[model samples]
Target chain A: MQNPAAPAWTADHFFAGARACIPVAISVAAYGVVWGVLAKQAGLSLLEVMLMSGLVFAGSAQFVALDLWTATPSTLPIGPIILATLIVNLRYLLLTATMRPLVRPGTEKRSAAAMWLLSDENWAMTVGEMAKGRGSIAFLVGGGTTVWCFWMVATVFGRLIGSAIDDPTKYGLDFAFTATFLALLLGMWKGKADLLPWLVAALVAIISAKLIPGSWYILTGGIAGSFAGAIAERRRGYAHQS
Target chain B: MLTSPEALLAIAGMLAVTVAIKASGLLLANRLPQTGFIAAWLRHIPGAVLASLVAPAVVTGGTAEILAAAATALVFVVARNLFAAMATGVIMVFLLRMALGG
Candidate 1:
């Protein structure tokens, strides 16, 4: 069946996207604050906090950066920090790769600007709308702008007040990262087809995380699991053909 | 306050690579085959990456962590709300750790 007329790339759709993302923006702000607090504890100066959050603009990567941060700049492991960020943010390649349908043809530059602001939350929201046959690039930009604003503000606020919270572990705040990521993984559940990939990824990650002393497990597991998924699908396809 | 060269370089490197990754996806989307093995693999990357991210932490975090992960998944599945599920997991881990004499 032909898709209905695509939504117009107008200000109205933009604002509608922003309004729809209010709840998600709230959650993003919450995580942003957590990251900010952790950044402060990790010996990041206020200026550093602003630059990292403003430029990097990725939650997981920022968090991992903190884990690799050193108190003294002279001894900082710059190479490892950058490498970890690359690995953590590599998932965006997949997230943003599926954006062809959202942007209009011949507008790659503008779409690149929009993609820069794309967070997991807004991307999911925009894609969800696409699945319903009622989304546009404006909607995505609107939602992404909202999330970006909240993240910048909340993270700065957390850094300013970081001194107040000396011990995050006392309140079990450390577990927040695991919990958030767990929920995200659960939210991605499609069906039985996902079982093989997820299992392989998890098992490989568990073993690699122990053997190697870095964030390489994420890269390795992601590659291994995705290949496993593709191979499984190929086999199923062959079975059907036969 | 002035930022160090190391910090600036690190952030710049991160910014460069991240932008490249995000932009490459959109720029290459047109060239990528929509239906094929590559597409199927791309479809699975998000879940696999997430699983890889969360698994080690959950597996090695001890009893409190393991239980909290379960609560996290259950709350997420039921409420379909990310914030609520995360809160439930945090609270469960907190209480469990205390009760078990953390």
Candidate 2:
């Protein structure tokens, strides 16, 4: 199917979405920048830094892969490391699905074009906007495109200047991504409605990480929380009936 | 080592598999009404999923770190202000890290 005609990008939509995306992009960019710099410091060539940032386009997964690659007594197979990184980034699958209702079905060309631009912040903001039902798609297109451009630029820039700086750790910029994610999570959480699941998942992750290594945090916590949540909701339904 | 042919092939195969699983499941979900237990379970995905990711980082980092991050989450939860909570936690942690000489 041909692309659906939407409203032209107005100044208002441009400003609105651009404003939303700027801070998100900055946090993400900073994280990517630090990753690039650290990856360089850790022995990635400028070529590797650029290639990974552009092609893989995953920040957290790259970090995990980097950590495992750099670990002292390397216990993991290279294939397993790659696959674990694959699982960590699998949330993108759900992200793409969330975007589907916003875009046309079977428009794989357009979807594929947009896939590289998708990330947690962008997807959440876009989905939240789309859920509101009256915002311009122009906001999404403008903001998402702007973010995609900057993420690459920041990574390359950080790699260039980062080596000159003696201690990137001194600035405490490393924790900013963690801060940003916490902020994002709070905003996304609706109410007391989700508090139980949130607590349960966190507890489960803490236990699982202690038990397993090599990024089992991604799998064990996810499975445990999901299963617990399922059970909890079923009991709630039973209570409502009683 | 990252550029080895073996590494590249591994990455490629993994990506292909991840994409296919997502695409197929999503296609089926669209055709389906998302009713029954699966849909109920799916609703837990976003929170449960993210907490699963974030908690390990905070938790294993130490209870002090976890509590500090929770202080951040608490403010956001209470005030419902995203930037304020994020900024305060980061600033507090930075200062604490500085003081502790970590």
Return the top candidate by lDDT.
Answer: 1
**Predicted candidate 2 versus true structure: per-residue lDDT over A1-242, tens digit per residue:** 22254344467875677678887887677666767766655555566666666666666667655545542224325665576666556556556655555444455454445455566666667777877764444566567666766778887887787778666446654454455557656775666657777788788778877887665665666666666776777788788889
Clashes of each: 0, 0
Total clashing pairs in model 1: 0
Using DockQ as the measure, which candidate wins? 1
lDDT of 1 by residue, A43-77 (tens): 88889998988888888788778877877889777
Off by over 4 Å in 1: A1-10, A74-77, A128-134
| Model 1 docking grade | medium
Note the Cα lDDT for every prediction shown.
0.84, 0.62
